[model samples]
Target: MKKVDTNKYTKLTLSLERIRGIITELPHNGHRFVVLYDDKPDKQGYIQTILEDDTLGEQSPYLLETRVYHTEDTFSHYRKSCTKAQEIFPYFEDFYKDIPFSYENWEEVTKEFLED
Candidate 1:
């Protein structure tokens, strides 16, 4: 028998305005912003992952990129600062928001689904 991964993927849904508010303050709180794109034709929403800048390192200097995922084939981008993060907010659907995750417990919080 093949063992299947039973971990479930979860996402929070909020208004776009709320999402923008959270992104604006990420830099002040020593955090980075991530946007997860949904490729499903019927689902036009996106998922936001907030990660610590220091934990991810500084390999890429560009403000945007094409990949950012661990267990899925979704398109994602990470921004190190508020300004760079906000640049792409306007392109997001007007229906998503993200709450700040504590850096100290980020791993615990994301470990379930983030694990490959």
Candidate 2:
């Protein structure tokens, strides 16, 4: 499993706007890690695990490496966020998932399938 400097993001209080900002504020090109987790059991356990890697595309400092932890758990979370990511930012799935552990967009698509 990969690790992120949680301290880096923890220094800042997170809210919906903040999560959105991380996504919006990131630089255009770079390996990005976008994690969406369930705010249930142990808290955002699964989703956050997904976005801990900043290894996508060629390494680029200009890259906006970040993880967006949303308060969403279960298939519904995936449905909502996945849909919103598409609507919020086209090519959103493409933004992340090339990295390992992603299972590609399939993790997001068959979220319910995987859970069961």
Q: Which one wins on lDDT? A: 1
TM-score of 2: 0.29
lDDT (Cα, tens digit) per residue for candidate 2, span 1-116: 21122324422334444445555533332314444333335443333212222343122222122233344444322322231222333333333222323333432444434444
Candidate 2: list runs displaced more than 4 Å.
1-13, 28-31, 42-86, 89-116
Per-residue alpha-carbon lDDT of candidate 1 for residues 1-116, written as tens digits (9 for 90 to 100): 10111012224444566555655555444436545444445444343534334344432221322233443454333323222555546434322223322223122233333447
Colliding residue pairs in candidate 1: none
Per-residue lDDT of 16 in model 2: 43
- Clashes (N, CA, C under 3 Å) per candidate: 0, 1
Worst 10 residues of 2 by lDDT: 57-66
